[model samples]
Target: MESNSSPSSSPIPIFSTFTSPFEGSSKKSDLTKKPLSLWPGMYHSPVTLALWETRSNIFERLLDPPLDAPPQTELITKTPSRSRMTIMYNFSTDYLLREQYRDPWNEVRIGKLLEDLDALAGTISVKHCSDDDSTTRPLYLVTASVDKMVLKKPISVDVDLNIVGAVTWVGRSSIEIQLDVTQPATADATDSVALTANFIFVARDYKTGKAAPVNRLIPETEREKSLYEAAETRNQLRKRKFKDEKKELDNGEVDKFEELLAEGRIFCDMPALADRDSILLRDTRLENSLICQPQQRNIHGRIFGGFLMHRAFELAFSTAYTFAGMMPSFLEVDHVDFLRPVDVGNFLRFKSCVLYTECENPDHPLIHVEVVAHVTRPEFRSSEVSNRFYFTFTVRPEAKAMNNGRRIRKVVPATEEEAHRIVERMDADSL
Candidate 1:
């Protein structure tokens, strides 16, 4: 276990020797530096599918999970370093590896990155909760939500990438993990930080499917202490926001939205304002639906949380691209909520919309997009929201001059309810 903090007092032996699925022409490093490659006989396997196999044994031990981690190994306290780990995507030298993560524009696919983060976070959670003397655990972990992920710089698909994650905080049945994505220093440039992400995972008993207690995480250093504190603050904010949504909007908030709604109506009623500069939110919508595939399922037999995020991100990217009339670059993932799990064979529908746009810089507009996932079941007569995702993107610099149609300068809500969502979903810290 390695990070900016101290090493774990007792690190898990298996994680200390874990390696990614790259078995060809690849030399494995210590657990701290597991270099990943796309080829290990599964030539065209989804990068995540192969990586999943590498970490599958951890799941099998828990409730998919025969549950009996050596009861004797259970400790009273665990530190952040105990779960710290890093993996590498050696795309800088592996052409085959780069192909799996690259998009049409030869840039790293944000969707794939989302999947990687989820997979890595899951492993970290397991590492933290593991008793460490058995196959893996007595508890199963699942992603609860992604607090945030922001790109510090544009990630190159052909560069080697390092993903490091560790446990930041833990409650009886919940764990907060933070991940940093960076590029190793090269001859021409110093080490570069590409992205940072925070994810929350909840633990459950394999046998009973009930919330299960995890190890106590005692911060061992100043950095770890700060991270631990921040996670607590963020958790409080999330709970507050959830409660706020159930309350009625105050007079001032309602007035402000009404004014914006009036402006959109004026733009529609007045012929002189129709320049296609502003788009009705409804006009920027795009949708897609698919049956949850078993190949994308996690060890628990439900569609992997990361796979769901992978699909939602691509849809959000498309919404931004079509709305902006240019290629879009991912900026940040503001927030996400996993309301429920989608099982294999379930019909999942993704609805994406251009929630809002900030065109302060005419050449590069910042677009906010929202994606809602619904588990639609006709026989059960329910089409409930299974997930909600919010993402931020901007027009690529080179593509700014390449307009697909009229420039999209604004996105205006056509209804009061839609107006409420736009205002409430905003994260003030990001602003």
Candidate 2:
């Protein structure tokens, strides 16, 4: 565990997203935090104190040259091992849920972990693209999308956590980084793997603002070769999916949507005819909006993708909680898309709803939630989707029983838009 004392050199600005560190004046801006009627969960954590202590140090570091611009040079091929990185948290030595990343429950807050993963991936992408011998960051990098993140095992805050990653694949401008989280073998138990995540980052020239070719990746080991191949396949699928979305209106999609609309209409008109209890998809919806803050900006000065993920995950959890009417345990985060970058001062709106549910087990129903983030400019009368998030959660049987034994209500799409969203999820699974 990191002590309260600050490092001599600047460490990463880990908590700058929550508190304003660079702004000097006290003038109230739209980005400033304001009073709210109600705040949820255990918001007070020791991390706040850490953030306060590091704010000044982080600001001083921000004064240094960003070095984002690098002179264009001849291409050079590099091995993936050159960019490999492994970061670990020694929480088992001295730790408490309130001292580190945790929520109302004693379990780890997945939202915070997602932020850490993004930071790590960003660092790796920088390392992979840099040709200079010095450690100064050079290339402009931004997260493109995330393939998938599945939690195979529950992560406990008290255990020493290890995050291992390396460059898996590369293109003219984009690079794929694979990160795996695990716990080392303990005296009592063997090593336990928790989750794996893949982050795609696109490299851009700071001056030309064009796609910057990265150093070619050469796999050193069999495992590395396998990973490279897998990433290539994933990339191919992404391209194909994008092409499919651009095709002209086909009968296949139209006919499928008609069936969904018809089924939804019948269920809405005759509720008693449903095989199991259900609810309208709109009823399971929840939303909140925020003014994008400069503190949350990435190195490129745009809103951080990880920050967006954190907000989207929280909204998705709330949607599932309302639908289940009980506290839910997070299962996994499936595929997600970062369609566009969100700029500072943008009115960011997050809309979430229960997309579907599995009630095979009445007590512990599986809930799939979707969250869509839009950057709305009321001044220009423009609202465009910037990202899409998908999350899965389930409630404990005992907790469900406490809700008067109300089984999870299956989500029925009543509108064409809703039907389209549901089909998108179904298609994403195959991808």
Candidate 3:
């Protein structure tokens, strides 16, 4: 099969419209009745109460069975390969930021797009595992990792978004889903690739909470074979990286300090920022904390992964903008690791800092921002790291030229360990 071939010629009916349970009822009096408060001092009308409940139920039913709950049968038929599972979403004005449409750099929020990708990948995983008898037991899936995501073009507000997700590879308990974002060609132009991503999800038995087996993906077409092979290559890389990280931590065989010293020599010869009152990493650092609200909860009643990712991205973007003193175009999101699940009502704290920057050319400056999420229990004043996100952005050339041709700020590591680690990670990413 061709890479761009449609999964099927017929309509896949991947999405289902929900009919509100209270759709056609002579409930004018009931609608006016006030419902109990969802929280302290937060009451809602009966109409809102009904709608919220119905919406939540519809989302849960459409997605997957509630976590730790009894298994429920799915309505859709199952397929073995990626060809049968496909999902597409159309973008609307609601997805765009007001007054930012004209700005080339300020297009659709990458956070929002990532959220949709996560949802679609999860949906595809479920469909791949679902079969006639398997539906009797619920299989819970969670995103373990999002591989490097590259954005080829900025997603404008007016164009419709075409997202397609399919199972590329599967393991004993994990499945890899490949998602491609594109804009369909119109009479005026041709289709363009916007972004591509690979997500790995692990299945768990709802009752036992143990790793569960997923159906194997049988690659019948050339496209499927290619995707499968790519997934395998990535899987191997992940394993190797993990092993190397463990080895480094255990033995410290590689001298990161020496590596940093070598790299520092290369940058030392470049123009120093001391000539101009330059910015430092501390100057661009930002910290934000907020309580996770119920609205951000997923069907499983835990904080949504996409919500966390969006928050992290926003913080990273702010850091990049502040350091660059210009609007930065998002280039790509590096590997995002979801360490643990966060519960609702927890205080989530985000700390963002400029990890690396290079502006020797002045015309083309690169900025790398890192955001780490921490979940805290306010009562105990205790916090645990939840996730880490790395992002890359490039500043507008014109803006860089406007600031007296000043060089972008450099991140000076205060501690030798930190300097070594940062340099090591940067070098690894380059490889």
- Candidate with maximal TM-score: 1
- Pick out the ten consecutive residues of candidate 2 with the lowest summed lDDT: 35-44
lDDT of each: 0.74, 0.72, 0.65
Give the TM-scores of the predictions, in the order they appear.
Answer: 0.84, 0.79, 0.76
Name the best candidate (by lDDT). 1
Please report how far candidate 2 places residue 154 from its true position, in Å: 0.8
RMSD of each: 5.6, 8.0, 6.9
Question: Candidate 2 residues 192-283, lDDT tens each?
Answer: 66889999999876656678888888886778889889999999988988888856546876776787777788777887886467677887
Give the TM-score (vs. native) of candidate 1: 0.84
Looking at candidate 3, the ten consecutive residues that score lowest on lDDT are 39-48
lDDT digits (tens) for residues 1-431 of candidate 1: 24544443222111111344443434444243333332121112344444444554554454245555423245458878777876777777777677778799787888888887887788788778777556544676789889878877778887777788899999878999998888766555574777889999998777677887888999988889998999999989888987876787678777868866876786668847754677788888999999977666666777888888989999999998887777788988877878998888899999999888887777667899999999999899989999989898987766866554346567777787888777776534344
lDDT of 3 by residue, 362-391 (tens): 677788888999998878978899998989
Give the local distance difference test score of model 3: 0.65
What candidate 2 gets wrong by more than 4 Å, as runs, is 1-70, 96-98, 133-137, 184-191, 246-256, 266-276, 361-364, 401-405
